[model samples]
Target: SIGNVLLLHDLVQAIPGEVVRWALLSAHYRQPLDWNQSLLDQSRKALDRLYGALHRAAGVETNGDEPPEDFLKAIEDDINTPGAMATLFALSSEIERAMTAGDHGVVARAKGELVAAGALLGVLQSNPAEWLEGEVSDALRIEVEGLLEQRALARASKDWPEADRIRDRLNALDVVVMDGPQGATWRVRT
Candidate 1:
């Protein structure tokens, strides 16, 4: 049974990182972990690392640098992010049900594993609407929007250098600008 679940979890994790997060969210909402300790450790460590950068940035000292407010806000938002706590509780409840039903002995041995999976799932489930909000802020959006607006002007003026500069700015923000027959369009790189 543990092996079966391991295979399942592995399969889930093997998918795109976004998919893994979504699946974890689903799993957290449906079941509770009761399996292996090692799995739990791994999951916890991942969460620690994933949020560490944001947390560290949040604690950054301006040191009279006068960093823009918008930049500071973005870091603060990431540091204060709230994920799927509800899903984890739901998952734990499901596990309790399984245990009560005299589920396989494998589950008993894999208690930590189960919790780890649920925790991992919880960590992954973030709101898609609020997702990119943490990365690119409203200020950044305004800047991009202005670029898109001036795109035609930049091209009409035969200012290839300026156009390329705008494109480079997008690239710096992890946006890939593509030049096609239909003109330039951009997408998030990752």
Candidate 2:
């Protein structure tokens, strides 16, 4: 065997499920693949960019910018992963530009194309919000919630400075707290 399955388990054990998928997805099928921690790390970064672009595209209307056909061409040529991934990188740039310009039609088309292309390659990380949040630990979540509660208490007691300080601290962690008539809720900052 090239590498024992049990031995490979250690290599993948520490990685997130999606990361394993990304690591494999990025590699050409017949080529000798180097399985390692760094590949998984790089996979996370690449997915972050691709998924981040999709999230950005979600808000804008499709601008009628059709998906480039090259990705499909590459796939048809016996699964040219490198070529397809390269094409996706370029498409990600296009999606970013369309989102920046608020071009609804182009954004919509680009997103669809991106998703379709990713789907063919089995690397479509659809839940960009969860992915982009970068795995918030439970302890961090609890701590953020605690600060939010403290902020609420400070506001009720008319301690504006304390409330503001709590908010600033949350801001530093990229946690966005929203105060509503019902209560306060928080989300990881985008």
Which candidate number has the best lDDT? 2
Off by over 4 Å in 1: 1-18, 21-135, 180-183
Residue 88 displacement in candidate 1 (angstroms): 33
Clashes of 1: 16
lDDT of 2 by residue, 113-162 (tens): 88877877667655775666556998988898799889989999999999
Residue 46 accuracy (lDDT) in model 2:
84
Q: Where in model 2 is the C-alpha error above 4 Å?
A: 1-13, 61-67, 137-190
What C-alpha lDDT do the candidate models reach, one value each?
A: 0.44, 0.75
